[model samples]
Target: MQFKWNYEPPTPERQKAAKELGEKIGMSPILANLLIQRGIKTESAAKRFFRPMLNELIDPFLMNDMDVAVDRLNDAMGRKERIMIYGDYDVDGCTAVALVYKFLQQFYSNIEYYIPDRYDEGYGVSRKGIDYAKETGVKLIIILDCGIKAIDEIAYAKSLDIDFIICDHHVPDEEMPPAVAILNPKRPDSTYPFHHLSGCGVGFKFMQAFAKNNGIPFARLIPLLDLCAVSIASDIVPVTGENRTLAFHGLKQLNQSPSVGLKAIIDICGLTNRELTMSDIVFKIGPRINASGRMQNGKEAVELLVEKDFRRALVEAGMINEYNEQRKDVDKQMTEEANSIVEKLESQKHLSSIVLYDENWKKGVIGIVASRLTEIYFRPTIVLTMSDGMATGSARSVAGFDIYDAIKSCRDLLENFGGHTYAAGLSLKAENIKEFICRFQAYVNNHIMPEQTQPILDIEEVIDFKDITKKMQADLKKFAPHGPCNPKPLFCTRNVYDYGTSKVVGRHQEHIKLELVDSRSSNVMNGIAFGQSAAARYIKSKRSFDIVYTIEENAYKRGEVQLQIEDIMPDTQKKNEK
Candidate 1:
């Protein structure tokens, strides 16, 4: 896929500030500029950004309804009331359920977790789940990740004498549910300092409040940051402010001493030796946890997460691994079919958005397919499939688009819908599929920016080979747990030529392994351009080309840094000069 390289050089004033800050901090100006771009203008802010502290976390009681939620929770445990920890079936939801259930189960005995079946109960607070709670004598249900929209279900649970304390992070409507307390940073009246916590993060805060109220040591909560890190990375939330602190510590916990379940998964993924990063969770561990929900029951994921026995957890992790493999197969097939359908669309090129429907498509993997389509076509996309006599599917948006609003615009046609700015889920009558498609596309057309329709590679900074030093790479490590708000820096280095050893090296010969040297320095840097073998001929011709990439430590050579090239283009500046 072609990309538009987006690099807005900092203004003179900002550059001066960055220079001054760099000199003050004894680092390169480029590193300081990246910090400034992320709104870290002062030394204190940069220090906090680099060295996130647990003590710096916001007071949990500062959140709206915290007092009520904590009081209700404490009362339930005080009376030994049977409490149910319920959650959605996604990663954020499963991790939230596991985290809460694990923590509370330590001190409270009358607690169990519930994950509604993706097929039988669908997403969020199902009537069946409420009935189960009623039958099981559950007096309080702490629903996580997805209760903000379950007004009717919460009422039903209430009628059965069950109270709800909801911990969610999704955008909420003005008319809130009838829960005993709702803890969501995105609530209309929320004054929580950080608004971007993951659903699990919200759950964590609830637990934090509970711990603080009970005078429990904060050290006990540190173990659960592994789950928070997973949810924060998997849910694709912004990693700034509170999130950064949680994820940074969570990653440390994961690498040093993970919970038994995550340790099992880490071993299964063959990543037990190396230090795990947020990227590892997003790519490896998160998928395995999510696969259980997609292919089977999400409860299995929670069960494994809260399991104490390593042997049992390993067996569960192995099963989850199989589920992940199955999910991948189904996801790949659905994505290919979706791509074929999109290719056949008569108005494919001109349309501002994409909505594809097929009754035969697997509902389990439609979200993955929709995400694949958005990445491939670079447009807001929704892939729907027939489920429970209704057309149900997931929607994915481009970098800056609010897909939730676009889906909300077609709510009349949709039987149910809820999600965030870049992703959502919806179901509608089969007959309304065509109208929903037209309406959703129209809304996107009316609101989407022209640039949002295209794939754009944001180049964070421009640097020469000389700037790619050991010190810079080490300092870059300070930017751990990168995500939405604080993304891994992307660098562009221009006019670099291959040093005679670039060659195709992938299993299908689809990648270029390069030994590169720029004119500014004689240092030969090792780089890998994945799936860019088509550019091998030009690169081999000794023609200088410009590249945009991220630097990472070479897995093969532990101490060496390698450029993971994103894109390579001919040297336009040098073309006229030569």
Candidate 2:
């Protein structure tokens, strides 16, 4: 349970530049330095960063094949062809399906949505789904969130006379699918301005192009931003560029006037009284939506999402909430069992990656288990379970590691695999599990940086207690909808001592609620250190310590700031070292 504090003090030249820029922009140098690190050097860029406007979003047509995708959709609608909306079962996929289905359903009635059963059909463009489309006389399918690697499946659908328009954001293989038009910013030939977008984000852009082509007012598209924001947050995509604008406005929509389905979920989560943030979606909202997919069928999630009646949506949300409870129970059990297995590994300390296989493990929850193992072990980890006589599983990676590539390196052993840099899904013959593990582990060991296998707290800046002002707090608040690339800034305060009122809090006394002061000022800052009560004795000894933390609004006291301390260590230790 140790963390490496990562902070490099600004050089004098950079400090001078930051100060000059701060003066030019009428802001603090620390805030300016943070902006500069994010590549916002000029005042206008900083202005745009803080207040990203909707009109500034990149033109949807700039994406490769966007015109073709739009034209195909227009042709389908004009001919009144039976259209089927399809997506994966996860939050991003469900949201994509819901966004496209809800938007198109307003003007068209010949459309239906499909979410393949995770257990029955597995992931991506399943053969069963294509057969269903064929059976139902559907002529076109708009598959979202997953389809980049579905070459064979798309061809199968094509043979069935069903054309496909794929809207995905995953890294694609060299050979593309035989869809009518594939819309992915990561495509090799893509000229899209932004490279990172969630699956739902891609679907939103497709709808945007469709709206523009049909002369539909842009205001009509605003309501769907809530789904886009949920997907962006849940999928952990970068919250910069076009994503920032979408998430920013999406959050406004979520807080001010959420869709009926989301409103039902909000009320169920007891968040109806407060403004929802990205964190709320990640921790509270997204999981509930995903639970339906994990515990049962994801169709329930899409049904709830696109439901028009509040009463019906509320009923659906209640069922989904029950599923979430079930998911939590299974996840806890699986994570504990996986940890025990890892603890028993003979080469636990020397191993660079983890590959655990248990046929009895639930396939739906292995992804969560893999994530937990990666966070705890600080290594690329894969958790596999038996599915359809194959060892199928989910892979999660440490920071700065590419898990998808690691799995791709063992593609010969894998029957199918696809994902992003940090997360992926793969399946291999049960007999190949042993070989896959050895190769995957060796690849990780050879490529992963030594420091990448350790937990690190990346401090954005070092600032004194006195520098935390109302204006600085407000400026930080403007950096909303924070995620992967544009994260909530983490600040380091060196040599700060606990005030007399600092004491253990929490039901089990596992946290420290702090009243702290620094040597430079008498300003006592309130902070909370979760799961750090082990440091309470030293803190009470009046010993100063360095703390790395992110500033957050005090939940109990609105408008007041609280330091959510991430890591704490004695001040005498070597600074900023692993």
Candidate 3:
């Protein structure tokens, strides 16, 4: 797929200021430029960004209802109340439950955890989960990663004499649940400094407050950060502010001294010798952790996360690995089937959205399929399957589109729907599927701009090949743990010629390996464009091109930096336009 490169230029004043700051800090100009681009303009901001200290974390009591949540937990613990840690089935939820449950276990043994089965209890707070709490004689329930929208469920639990402390991070509806304390920063009345925390991050903050109130030093809770980091990475939350600090420290803990379960997973994935990055967790650890809930019971994932013995954790990790393999196979097959359905649609070219449904589709993998479909269709996409006699589905949207709003427009047909701007989940009567698809397409067609449908490569700046250097790469390393809002910088180098050594190099020759030389400086650099073998033809024709890429150290060749090409376009400005 081709992308429109959107160049972002820094102001001259800002550039000069950053350069001066870099000189003061004894760093390179490129590093300074990148830092300034990320809003780290001053020496103090640079120090905070590069060396995130745990003490820099905001006080947990500042969050809305945080003190009340802590008081409620203390009350439960003092009375020896049976407290249940309730969470959703995904990684964020499971990790949240594990983090809180394990922390509580350190002082109290009366606490237990409950992860509702995805197949039986769709998502969030459910009657089955509440009923389980009642059966276990639980007096207090700590709801994590969910329950912000469970007004009715919370009411029902309250009726059963159960109190709830919600720690969700999703966008909440206007009518909040009557929990003892709601710890979601997204709450309109919330005063938390950072609002983009993951579900587990909120749970971590709750524990932080609890530790402080109980006279337990906050430093003692640092070991729980690995779980928080996994949740942040897996949940796709913005890695900025407190989230960055948590993820940074959490990743260090994960690399240096991970929990037994995380260590087992790292070993099983053959990553024991290497440091794991956010991408590694997202692709390697996250999926395996999620596969348990997607393919089987989420309780297994929580169990693995809470396991204390390395030997037992390995056994559990092995079982989870098998589930992951099964998940992959199901996901691949369903995606292919969804693609074929899109191909067979006669109006596919004119349609503003892609909506497909299959009765046989496993609900577990439909979300993955919806995301995969968007890569091919590049529009608001929904993949639905029959679940409990209802048409249940997951919706994925383009970059600028509000999929939740579009889905909301069809609320008349939906029994329930909730999520954020880019992704959402919904279920409706089987007969409403056709109407929902038609109305959804109409809404997107009217609201989505033409350019919004096309993929966009957000280039941070345009730079010469000579600007790429070992010092620049070293300085960029300080920008550890990059994600939304603070993404790795993408630079576009224009009018670069690929040396004759350029060749297609991957197992299927699907990647282009090129030695590029800047037209202005004659500086050479190695560039690799994965899944871009088509670009080899342009290289073979000796065409000058503009390439958007991120600089990375080529680990295989020690001490060598290379360009990881994001997109390539022919040098069009040099040619006369029509």
Q: For all the candidates, what are their Cα RMSDs to the real structure?
A: 1.5, 1.4, 1.7
Error of 3 at 180 (Å): 1.2
**What is the per-residue lDDT of model 1 for residues 218-337, given as tens digits with 9 covering 90 to 100?**
889999999999999999999988999999999999999999999999999999799899999999999999999999999999999999999999999999999999999999888888
Q: State residue 76's C-alpha deviation in candidate 2, in Å.
A: 1.3
User: Which residue runs of candidate 2 sit more than 4 Å off their true CA positions?
Assistant: 572-578
Estimate every model's Cα lDDT from 0 to 1. Answer: 0.92, 0.93, 0.89
lDDT of prediction 1 = 0.92
Residue-wise lDDT of candidate 3 within 256-368, one digit each (tens)?
A: 99999999999999887886899889999999999999999899999999999999999999999999999999999999988898998989789789999899999988988
Q: How far is candidate 1 from the true structure (C-alpha RMSD, Å)?
A: 1.5
lDDT of 2 by residue, 108-166 (tens): 99999999999999999999999989999999999999999999999999898899999
Q: Candidate 3: where are CA atoms >4 Å away? A: 521-523, 572-578
Number of residue pairs clashing in candidate 1, backbone atoms closer than 3 angstroms, sequence gap of 3 or more or interchain: 0
TM-score: the better of candidates 2 and 3: 2
Order of candidate numbers by lDDT, starting with the best? 2, 1, 3
lDDT of 2 at 355: 93
Candidate 2: lDDT of 161?
88
Look at candidate 2 and tell me the lDDT of residue 511.
100
